[model samples]
Each structure stands twice: as structure tokens, then as C-alpha cells.
Target: MNRSSYPYVKTPPIFRCLIKKQQQATEELTYKPRRRRRRKVNNSDFYWWGFPIGTGGYVIIRFLLTIDWDFGSFIIFMGAVAIALISGYLLIRSYYRDFKSEPPPEYIVNKEIRKKAIDAKNKIRKRYLSRPLKDKVKKLLKGKVRTLEPLTPSATVGVSEKQFLAVLQKYFGQRVNFPNGVFSIIGTTFEYTPDIVYQDSYTGLTIDIEIDEPYAGKSKEPHHCNDNDKDRNRDDFFLKRNWVVVRFAEEQVVKYPVACAYYLSKVIYQLSGIRYEVPAEKLPSIPTWDSEESTSMARLLHRETYLKEHGLWQIRIS
Candidate 1:
């Protein structure tokens, strides 16, 4: 009623602060940044600024310190150069925060190439060289060794295994052990034997090479189908024991025996650093087999039809 609010309720300091903050928030919500036009950054200027500070700094430091020019310096210089180049375009990125421009197409392409190269390098390293390759049981006294041994061989050996053994023996020589050579977990009755076992006696590296036939020869029942939980469990068991398991279709082993041997050699080298050279080598692309098609393979074989890479081989289920 026109009275100065009956009594002057001195605004509480917190309330006043809250009101200010709310006003600021409201203003921020409504505010739209106005685009300001500025001269585009020149290519020459950008390039000049792009020189990596780390490399430039290294040069300056070396000059000032009168560091002896030798292999060590060269190595250190290369590292500095790598750091600089990898950090940004041409310059150390952190120092030139003010510079901004759309990277040229060439620069973008080069960047993408570099990223892909790095990813490829990492993939190879992580899978084969670096990272964890396989879980090797360790001895407390000597530390980690990539082997678990005194294997319990499997109960049965398939025909395909014996056939492929001859092929592997050609390349691997005595390194290949004829199978029923599988592993059994300690304190458990579980056991599995691969078709072929390649054990590097010196390094104690073991590889399990298996041939997957779509169905059992006698039973005409589907085996090694994708949905088979037993295969996965068996694989896990061996893998945990630090074994490298390689599976091949029975057809691939029979027809492309030499190629299979060559592939095995390459895999052995990659995993255990053992190298082999095959005289007549021709690697062909083999299609991956899956469970659904394997089921079909089983049905076909039951009808007295040979599977022959039937997981959609050179022909579909007609």
C-alpha cells in the first residue's frame, strides 16, 4: 500500500548473492555469441609458427651447453624431433595456443595417415610383440616364463590331424610333436589334445594347431559348430595355460597343405620369434566358417555329401 514495504527487510547477503547469480545465469541462457569477422590466418605465418618448440629448444640447449656431437646426441635429438612432430602440425602445440586455422587437406591427410600407421603399429605390437601375448605360468624363483608343461595329452587323435602333421613336419621339422599331446588342468580331470603341437624346446613356447571338421566322421553329428560351448571352454582352458591355439577348417588343411604350413610358420615366428622359410609358398584367402553353415555342413554330410568348406565355400547351399 505505498508504504516502503512496512518494515525494511534488509536483504540477506546470501539472498542478494543468489539473486545476482540467478540474473547472471538468466543472461547467460539468453546470450548468443555474435560472430566476428577476422582476417584468415596466412599459410606462411602458420608454417613459421608451426616449428616444434621441443626440437628448437633442444637445438638451442645443445648449442648453449656445447654438447658433444655423438650417437647419444643424435638419439636424443631424434626423440626430441619425434616428440615435437607428433605433438602438433609443425610446432609444439601447447606454446602456440593462440594460433587457430583450418588444417589444409594435405595436413589432414597426413594426420590421418599418421594416425592409421600408429594404430597399425600398436595393433601389431599389442597382439604379437608388446602387451600380453599369452598367460605363461611363472616360477617364483625365476619370475615369469611363457610356458606351462608336463601336458596330459588328449584321448583321441582325428584323421585330419595326422594328415596335417605330415605337412607341418615338412616345415617345422622335429619341432612338431605328433598329437594326443594336449593339456589337462591340474586338480581337474579335464583334458584336450590339439591335432598338432609345436613346442619350441629351447623357449618352451607351445602352439596348438587344430583342424575343425564340420561333423564327426562316424557319427555324422555336428562338431565345432559356432554355438558349441565345449570348444570355447576348451580354448579358454588352453589359453589360460599360455597356449597359442590355431584352428583350421579340415578342407584347408587337406587341399592347401603347403599354405597351411607356411601360415603356421609365420604364426610361430610371430608368437615365439622362430623363423622358417618355405621354398614354394602361395598363401590363399580362406573364408571363415561359422556355426549356422556348419550345421548345414552336418546335414549335408548326413545326406552323404562332403562338406568341402561348405560354410559358403565356392558354392552356396543349393
Candidate 2:
């Protein structure tokens, strides 16, 4: 019935930190004395340490004549005094023997032990408590939709998908397919087929190319909403199967289909380490859209306005 029992109340890091602090407190706060060398004592070293610690030679005015306490005389006298003090310090420091280090006490070790305990506790809290919220905040801030769920291969290919497919085929001839690739998570009845599947002959990298329309045509519901977890889960599913998933906006495919293909080939080369020649030499600025934003725009039929404003990749929304 005791709540303080180790199994019921214990967090290992807290217990471990307490034990570590106890160990540190009982630890001997000392050091091995520095070993002195056995070299014969140099009389010159002792002279350097002792004889030059004076400013006697800095007495600038001769006692034989009346001296003027002018600015120039005072300046010279002060300069000589500074130089003599510096020389004395350097001479003594050069040969002075000591066993003690700069901090002079081992009490700093206790401070370090306490600091380490605090840091360890902070790390434990971060691991257990703080990180999930932090991860969620980060997810919200990174508001770009990079990919979406692939279309079902059984259905007819849409006009936008066909255009993207034709361009992808120009560079990756015979390597790309339409409605040919079928994949599913194990122990599940559901099967996902990408709109176009590209298999690299050299590196065997499988690419799942998807053209995501803002909203589902029949359901009138958002298919790739930013708040929706389905597409993210879908991408994760493909990732687990070692397939690289890439999504393009329907407009991006329709407008710059050739650029879309070039971009895809470059992505393929980057992912697979094999380059394929495409007709377009310059990299096009085919900006992607947030899934939720896409869904909203599609629902309102504000595609042109959204494209005009969020046309570049710099604008982001979660």
C-alpha cells in the first residue's frame, strides 16, 4: 500500500541523479600533488625571482641639480616604473615554483556536480514531458505539403495525371508505368496504387508519383487537407516500404508538365545516384501547396487567386 515504493513511485533518472549526487558528495575532493623535477637548483632562477622586484633604477632626476616636476619628466618616470614592474613580474613568474592550480580549491568540482545533476534532470524531462508538445509546435510551423495519397490504380487516370505521366516517360522511358504498381500494408485488406510508378533500373529505387487534386471529385470532402492525417500516414506507409513518395498539385502538373518531369528526374537522380537526361536544362520553380490550403481553395474555386498569391514556395501555412 506504500506509494513511495520504487516500482510505483520511481522515475529512474531522478533516482539515478540522487545517487550520483550522493556519490559526488562523498567523493574525495583532492588531487595528486604535482611532481617536482629533480634538476639541481639554479642560483640564477632564485636571483631572477628576488633581485629585480624593485624600481630603484627608475629614479629619473639626478640629486645633483634642482629638478623640475614637469609633465615630460613625470611621463618618463611613470614609463620607467611601469617597465620595471612588468620586468619584475615576468622574471619572478618565469622561475617561480608552485604546486597549486589556478582555481586553488576543489570546491568547483561540487558546483560542476550540481550543474550536471540539473542538466540530467532537464534532459529527462525533455525526453518524457516536453518533446511531444515541442514536436507538435514544430509540425505546425513547418506548413508545407510535400506529398499526398496516391490515386487508386483501378480508377481511370485523370487528365492532369496523364500529362504528368507523359513528361515523366520522356526521360524515364519504359521505366515508368500507369496503374501498374500495387502496394499494401501487411495484414490489411486495403491496397494503394500510385497514379504513376517509376522504378529506377540502375538503383532499384521505387518512386510513387501522385497528382493531388485539392478535393475529392465525388465526396466534395477534402482529401489532402493539411489538418488531415490520412496523406501523412499514407506517405509514411510508402516510406516504410522504401518507396519515395512525391506529390504535385493538379495545377502544377497541368501548367508545367514538362518541368514537373524534369524536377522528378532530378529528384530521382538525387535519391538514386543515377542521372537521366531530360529535355529541360533549367530547374523550374514549381512551388508546392499545403494540403489544407489546396482543399480550401478547391472548395471555394479560388485556384487562380491562390496561385497568384501563394505561387512561390516562400509562402507557407500549416
Candidate 3:
């Protein structure tokens, strides 16, 4: 039986399916343009285009001043320049339109495409919400703690708890307090030692301030994950009792002592309706501490020694 004699040779079902898929893939590859997802235009786009345009203006001005040419030649040159500028402007406008235009309904209605749109919107929202917190964190890290101290009002200040609280007291007097008390969380009692507590003498408003260090307990052990849970519980207890809660990292206290003082002073004045001032003559001598470096290192040692030698370092936070 010759193969040619069999007018219809049956192909296997699996092979037929594979051939169909291959043809479909080939058609998709050939017919579709390999276009990338268009990105949103930003202010940088204007700056990027503006620089060249600005430079070209100067070049044209210089050309006009230096060129020894007839009026006819100048007119022709100007005409060409005008045409080029117009074309460039139109090209940029078209590019912007192409990018900003919405995709076709079929493309937009696709489940994957819709999901991407949702995700992109959520991502932007998250970033916008987190911006302030991130900026504060950056300020803390940059050592521009915005201290209230006149010496370096725009910079970070001290490097120790003693120094931090000293600056606070130096200005606010007896308003600053440290209290160890008991509080309830979820019907359970926990001993809470607030780093600093301020009670407004006039208004009787209370504020609980916590300065967290990397270590825990009198033994100075490293903080475990569960430590945060305990801290949160303590904070909740204060909030339940109608006390205003404020938390600062130890680094923030040390690095931005003056800023911390200013911040606390502002809170106190707002709470008590009483304004306090640091004596101009009593202000401590400020050492040349660079904002670019951490005071916790050798820089801290030097500061401590200097303060000690000058009888300026207070051993007690009070």
C-alpha cells in the first residue's frame, strides 16, 4: 500500500494540537509589535529637554553676534531654526500624548492588566502615606535633629541620657520628672518605668515619654522580639489612662538632645499653657560636633572629656 495511494493520512490528535498552538504563536509573534509598557512622564523630563533647548538659545545668540553673513542668509538660517524648534516641540508633545493615552478597552479589561492597575495604585498610596515617617527617620539619621539649643539649633546635640535630660532641665527647670509605676494591660499588671514623665503644673495634663535603648533590664541584655510586645502593652496602658504617649529611640535622645528638648518644651507649653525659657548666660558651651559623624564613637569620648574638664557635664539627668 503506497502512502500516496492513501488520499487522507490521519495525523495524531496530539500532533495536530501542537501544530495549531505553534501556528497561533507564530501569528502572535509576527503580528504584534514588541512594545514596552509606557512609563509616566515626570518633572525630570522637562529638565532633560530644557537643558538642550537652553543651550541652543545661547548657541543661536552667539551665532547671530559672531556670524558675518548677509541678511538673506540670516533670514534663511532663522527660518530653518524656527522649523527645527517647531518640529521638536511637536515631537515631544506627541510622545507625551502617546504615553499618557489610556490603553484600549480590551487591554484594560484583561484581568492581569486590571490587577496590575490595582497594585500600582496601592503601591503609590503606600508610598504617599509613608513619606512623612520616612522623612522623619531620614532627619534623625542625618544628625540634623533640630535641637532647641541656640548653639546648634539646626543640628544634633548630646550623646548620653544624662546629657539629654540635663539639656531638658537646663531649660524647663523642675517640670521634667521620672516615675516608676504600675499599669494594666489586658487585665494584667506590669511595672512601667517611664524614661521621662512631664505633668503640667497648671493643667494637670500628663505626658509619658519613653526612650528605648538597644538593651533591656539592669543586666543590659540585648532586646528580644518579645520586648516590643511588652513596650506596646505599656503604651496601651498609658493611653487607656488618658495620658499622652511619646516614644523616642535612644539614638534620637543622644543625637538630637537639643531638638528633643525643644520638642518636649513645645509639648509642655502646649499642655500647660506656660512658657519656659533657658537662661542666656547659663547656656552650656557647645563643642564643635560635626553633624556628619555620630557622637557615640570617639567623638563622644572627646565631648565627655571636654564637658568634664570644663565642669559642664552633669552626672544626673535632673
Model 3, span 228-300: residue lDDT tens? 4665565555654556566554544555566666666654443333566643221122222122332233333
Superposed on all Cα atoms, model 1 deviates from the true structure by an RMSD in Å of 29.6
**Global lDDT of each candidate:** 0.56, 0.55, 0.48
Q: Which ten residues in a row are the worst by lDDT in model 2?
A: 3-12
TM-score of 2: 0.50
Residue lDDT tens for model 2, 158-209: 5456556767777788788785535655698776767787764444456677
What TM-scores do the predictions have?
Answer: 0.48, 0.50, 0.34
Quickly count the clashes in candidate 1.
Answer: 3
- Please list the residue runs of candidate 1 whose C-alpha ends up more than 4 Å from where it truly belongs after superposition: 1-154, 185-188, 280-292, 302-318
lDDT by residue (1-318, candidate 1, tens digit) is 111111001221322343353334333122223333344567765465555554566664675576577787777777766665665564344344344666457656766776777667555544532323222211111222234345656456665566568777877888886653345566987766666777766656667777767666666667676566776677666665556677776666666778878777766554444578865566554444456765676666632343344332333322
In model 3, pairs of residues that clash are 147-258, 147-259, 148-258
lDDT score of residue 52 within candidate 1: 59
Q: After superposition, how far is residue 78 of candidate 3 from its true place, in Å?
A: 48
Displacement of residue 278 (Cα, Å) in model 3 is: 5.6
Q: What TM value does model 1 have?
A: 0.48
**In lDDT terms, how accurate is model 2?**
0.55
- Among the numbered candidates, top TM-score falls to 2
